[model samples]
Target: MSIFRNLSSRAKEDELMDDFSMGGAELSEALVHLRRLNKIFAAPGPTRYGVEKLWRMMGSPASLSVLDVGAGSGDVNRKLLEWADSRGVELHIILVDLTEEACQEAAALFKDEPRIQVQRADVRDLPDASADIVTGSQFVHHFDGDELVDIVSHMLRASRYGVVINDIHRHQVSYTAVWLTTRLISRNRYIRHDGPLSVAKGFTARDWKELKRRLNHETMTFSWKPLFRYAVVIPHPLKPGGKESGIGYA
Candidate 1:
């Protein structure tokens, strides 16, 4: 199939970062480039949007604990910390990734920061209700079919409040833009190959709708964001006599 066509379905090809055993200089370089690209594309926007929306919906809690799955380099949460500081919210973030290298990278990045912790583990193994919020940034597209559903179910179960997913939006324009941008700016082989591939692996509106249907959750809300991304927020059900909260979209 031509790379330029057949974007109607999510791509099944595995990214180099999918291998947890990958480590050392090459992986380190790739992580660095990934951080830069994420910043350049404002990739952290969706996660912040989801979290803030949920926080407000929950009546602007004074503190929040977030579990960030597949948290590479912990760059996104680093930005989250800044946002929390500005808003006077006490934020504790746990960054989890399957790769030892990623955990090490995050550890080094957040070493002096007591607000963040880095762990190398499978997200599925996490205990239920471990955090107030669970977030997956550019993470969920790595799996498909039953695995995808299972992973998301675990995320929802692991969070006391909700789960936020920030992922790519599969489109011809996004794929082409990423393909060219990575080639121009990144020398790391992983970044060059996986950047465009991530777009192809991204979700469409119908894809999110189907996943939501399969999960049978009524509180889930998803919306498109600038720069070709989707922010999916699933708030936990309110207790008896609890008032519903509003979600503001971008």
Candidate 2:
């Protein structure tokens, strides 16, 4: 529970914990509005900044690949496409999620684009592998404690480049901002419920530290970007010769 305090935003989901926030037409509507909501209410800085940083540090994305775990509706994937296009980098995106309907919707959005692939699966059950970069947005907070550690390990193992988890920071200020923003801009029921719930389940830098300590590797770093009432977390890749990569490995 102490770790739970680190992610105060998740506390609000108490009223709506049963909602999968995925499935059926409601899920589709949430997916649509969420993309709009993120653009208007939860955008990640000036777009190419984070990806740019990774490229500068890692060399190039000319051959980079990315995996979006729990890619609800391709909003993040859409952003990735934009980033790749802007940077002249070739990106191969694998979108995985628990709900087939959501993944199917995402696939429809990018089916014609050979660079993207979608799968209906739990991230935890997925295989360990490597990609130039691995990323996820608005989805990490759904995991806490050991579940969070396991997911991070999966990301680390699956990425040859790095892992970037962009989500909300769990704090009173972030929670308030999100709640009000959802009330003001979005009109979906699942959005209204899952929006605040996401905040409550979010992780703080301190919580991340505890989770990292549990891992077999000792060379991971965690970077935080708390902006526009949201949080951008970067978990760097583990060094092949070193114990493991630091945070923001994506």
Candidate 3:
């Protein structure tokens, strides 16, 4: 089968960054380049859109806590903090990743920022209703099948308000763009190999639809965003008393 054909199905190949033990200078360099690429593509746009939508639905709380799963380098959360600051809202963000190196990098990046915390753990292990909002950026594409469903289910359970997933939209155009852009901007082997592979591992609207079907979440919505991205937003249901069904904030 030709690589360009069958773009409807998600590619199952593992990315170079899939290895949680990866670290050192090369990993560090690749992360820097990935952060730069995210900025160029406005990768945080979809995430912010989902988050703001949920926030507004929650009546624009003065303070919010966000838990970001598979938060590589935590660059996206940094952008979220900036957005919250601009809007005069306080945001306490928790950055979770399976890799120690990623946690270290995130720690260093937010060393002076008291509002951010980096934790090395799986999202599934987190306590229920630990955060007001749960988000994943360029993260969910790493898994498929039952694992993907379980992870997303846990994210929904872990949040009191909603879940926001911002990830690449698998398409030939996105794949080509990432393939060429990585080659032009990064000499790191990992970036060059995984950039396009990430696009290949991306999802489509049908994929999200299937995932929602599996989870049986009727309110979940998946929408296309700029630069070939998908924002999957799921707002938690409210109780009859006009409060969220989850535990109240302290």
Candidate 4:
């Protein structure tokens, strides 16, 4: 258990050798494992909750556009779409990832999903206010410091409604639990290494407070969710009063 708390601090680690770029049957299998992990742990639920918050804020718009940053395999986007559909809300999802392979995979997965589009692009380079809301799940932990600021800023800027980021919470219990669970159910080397690594790279509540202070954005809201996940939501800037209003915090 002590070994699971090996990281010096909440600082980001170097990017793991993610299997999404391996470009073969191996990548496909790795992605399958990744999707399974997200499903088993219900990683996308908090992101959907964030979207629900934004939807209510928008006066329950008939349609919404969401940009999912670092949308590996776009599983989160798929779940979000399903959630909106159940509520009779039309959803258009844009899946963005740095790896072309990831984009291609998402595109293929959602080809039947006429409302979904996939793009390979850097978050920093995305144009401003491109979607109704920008969402990411298990994504922000991959960046730190200036890069984290840039990503969050870009997500907020791209969302006409808001930004929702769902990521792990860095804690010894969180890390140890994921470490044990992944080892038991997953044989993918990437999952075994990156799962715990992701947890370790995740932020503490204190870290989120400091990050919000540094960003100096008045509209941003952060809360801890079930399953040791953090939900960070930044409401639309055009909203009256310019503060996160009415949305319930977890």
Error of 4 at 114 (Å): 1.3
Lowest summed-lDDT stretch of 10 residues in model 1? 241-250
Instruction: Indicate the TM-score of model 2.
Output: 0.78
When 2 and 4 are scored with lDDT, the better candidate is: 4
Which candidate, 2 or 3, would have the higher TM-score against the true structure?
A: 3
| Lowest summed lDDT window (length 10), candidate 4 | 241-250
Candidate 1 residue 199 Cα shift, in angstroms, is 0.5
lDDT of each: 0.88, 0.65, 0.87, 0.79
Badly placed stretches (over 4 Å) of model 3 are: 1-6, 238-250
CA displacement after TM-score superposition, residue 160 of candidate 2 (Å): 2.1
lDDT of 2: 0.65
lDDT per residue for candidate 3 within 124-177, as digits (tens), equals 899999999999999999999999999898998899888999999999998888
- Residue 153 lDDT in candidate 1: 94
TM-score of 3: 0.92
| Residues 73-168 of candidate 1: C-alpha lDDT, one tens digit per residue | 879887788889999999999999988778888999889999998888888899988998999999999989999999999998898889999999
Assess every candidate by TM-score: 0.92, 0.78, 0.92, 0.88
